[model samples]
Target chain A: MAYEKPLPQPTAIDAPYWEYLRQHELRLPRCQECGHIFFPPNKVYCPSCLSDRLEWVKLSGRGKVWSWVVFHQRYFSSFANDIPYVVAFIELEEGPRLMSTLVDCDQGEIRCDMPVEVVYDDITPEFTIPKFRPIR
Target chain B: MAQMTLYDFKDKVCFVGVGDTNYGALYRTKDPRRNQYTLGVEAFKAALDDAGLNKDEIDGLILVRIPSYQLFADMVGLRYLRAANTFRGEGRMSALAVQYAAMLICSGLCSTVAVVYGNDGRSVGATYGGEGEGSSPYDVLYGMTSPGAAVAHMWRRYMHEYGAREEHLAAVATSNRRHAGLNPKAVFRDPLTLETYLTSRYIAAPLRLYDYCLINDGAVALILTGAERARDLRKPPVYLTATATCTDLTFFYTVDDFFRDGVRRCAEAVFGASGLTHKDIQVCQIYDNFTPTVIFGLEGASFCKYGEGFQFVQNGRISLGGELPVNTSGGHTSESYMQGFGLHAENIRQLRGEAGDRQVPNCQVAMYICPAPICAAHIMTRR
Candidate 1:
């Protein structure tokens, strides 16, 4: 067995979104009334229209590097060996954003607004971590 | 969308009594009862003493991070309690706290309100990451695990966008340390230089140890009463004129404007309400949870043009007697990181001309800006 890092516990509202990730797909809730798309699969209502009507929809899994950070110090023992790894906010084409590990990307080569695509990794049988790769 | 008129609470309510526990006392002490509650009680008693009023006279209370307000109200032996609420210290607490106090007073629901904050965050072994239970949910897997990491991302982006030099970040840390040297209440008063700042190891790239705030323990309390009765207590009055709070449901571009989003909204609301501009501010006590936060706040509050913040503090302009003397008590970097609680206490002291060595002369107006997911702001003026 491999070491497991802390994983997000999907609540009832967000379970379906995680289920989609298990199938190697990225999706979020789109507000049916106001047509607003949002992330984390936990939103219960349209943030703009104040309507609780929403539906799960697949995202294009595309975005630009809105921002990035390289942690020089290990924040957790699970990541002690992974020092100097990149974490970034992916501003998706559909307007929602997700926080994910940026892999297959050099720390020196990372730039703001760089185009990227999502790649999924099964960290554990119970978890599939969604990561990003630079669009070369 | 209609431009809603925020009911003018300008100069309607004023901070009468303010109190702070001795800095670094509990952070350094191993005493059995050096927790937040005891510190809060001490601060509350100090405020009551400063105001020369009985504890029972306070009809309303607002506490941050110190759970169970009913227990506090009971401990104070206040027979008549009219109103009380708790605001999350994790967000724009200090600014929102003063605003809530003023609103409660003006609405006639509470004649006098006590806004109190107590935190032993660092002393209690609370880690500064996603693992911490009291703050924003961090994604540990992605290394978006702590505020330091998140701010590192923002700082790098800011630097890349504006062409900021390493010296620019160093100047902020260097100048704040000099200010801390003058404040007896600051936790770290040792002098810091540009050379030292440059050499400090990085916690997260683009943000060195020098860029981070100290974790310590302390409590701050302020008493708010109608402006009519403010003249009867304490040294001088710091009026709450024009306060605003606006939240961006998500910062990942769902709310546009990147780092400047919240501050811009708060700045518009506050300045729009009052006839005051950024130039009218004599001093500013911005939230310094991270060094870049100060730079972003300056841009958000319209002190300078977008991306001009790095250049604004060039040539020691943010030091005492500079174009703007920011965080005169070293702020969170050199001072205690009581979140933004200390900034409120600093605002009152500056207005009262009691900031000792770091006092900005003619301190007529001051501001505290907490630019976060929840953008909140407060402006204080002396009449």
Candidate 2:
């Protein structure tokens, strides 16, 4: 049986972030000058203060549901059986928001500001997708 | 800064040719680029033929999806004297093209310009389902699947924030459907009722099946030339009097106000440039991607004050023969959902007095609002 492989493309700017994902760590670049955290890490300068000094920091993997939607339509063949899935933008404790799928809870139970924690799902041998589940 | 007058570009440029292909459910074979090229070629040929000119005479080309600096010149086989790529929302692409083409013509760098747009949503195999590149990581992580889901989130917020009822939005859908019934090219011409709109299965909370624009494959094109030379063309020229665009930097969150600030700014600027106000606009081709979008635009454009847009439409003020006839060719709601391309083509028809059943009598001026979240407005007049 031929197994389908999920594709992951990483550029130089994002390689470090993806590398961290391999270790089950959520890493983002924080501007030492402005104390701002940015995702999809960039090189050299801070977008906020144009400061060159930056540091990579691991996040707490906890956040609150800022907004959410339940999609009844399947957008991908891989997700066809996963219809009526819940997608949300969670406001992390670090002040940036992350988009992820909500799992382990009924769609009716999801609400704004609901507490959630990140959970990793290993889909393929080399890949893991980040999903969120209600803390309760 | 003085208050700018609206409808001010009296002798700037004019539309010489207009063409469009059928709009319907997604095509099964064509990709987006092919759809664009086919529609571009058809509209380009028709415009050139209609003007009794050749393709080589073209000096400028403007497009939305493809960049001008890319292989567009090679692919289209025209060495443009000038070219522009507009990356804003799709609906405003053509209108902005018209504005840029006019500037090129006015600057003497180009005598003739072609503005084209096309999309084969059906044939592209995506059908609003597949994910594209560079989507926000936040959006992808949360399983934000389609535009419907995102807009539904916004719609729910708007309803909650403004106390807007579902029926208020249903009126817009039903009205567009009623108007589409008179448009021969409209895909879903069956008259829709408020009950039907309300009862339809939800794509997301507070949004019914009818609230969204059908993702159809279609293309529309227009030719822009100097207004002085417009009279010699085969088609009656529709004068491009004024155009303006405004953008809000805040992407998803900043626009949570939903009052359409960018749309209001564009409308005010265009109207100021043309020396005309919303009252002077006899016909309007407002973008209706989602029903509430129209209501938001109507209010934001100052056609009516905020909170009064629903009442204005409820009183039959936007229908044909009403105060301000809108989307007579069914707009995106009933007509083809070529993004905002259908709205522009319909505007041209109205200005030319060629709109059959839905024509507003003696329409001297038409205002087209393309709200991409980033908003643009253009005022065209009968020559």
DockQ for all candidate structures vs. native: 0.59, 0.30
TM-score of each: 0.92, 0.81
Off by over 4 Å in 1: A31-35, A44-56, B1-7, B132-138, B251-259
Screening candidate 1 with a backbone cut-off below 3 angstroms (N, C-alpha, C), the clashing residue pairs are none
For residues B24-142, what per-residue lDDT tens digits would candidate 1 score against the true structure?
Answer: 55556766677777778888888888777678789999998788787777766765778887777674677777777888898898988998888877668766764444323326656
Model 1 chain B, poorest ten-residue lDDT window?
B130-139
Give residue A55's lDDT in candidate 2 (0 to 100). 87
How large is the C-alpha RMSD of every model relative to the true structure?
Answer: 2.8, 4.7
| Model 2 regions more than 4 Å off | A1-11, A15-27, A39-44, A57-64, A112-136, B1-11, B22-36, B48-57, B63-89, B131-138, B165-167, B202-208, B232-236, B249-259, B304-317, B321-323
Cα error of candidate 1 at position B245, Å: 1.8
lDDT of 2 at B177: 84
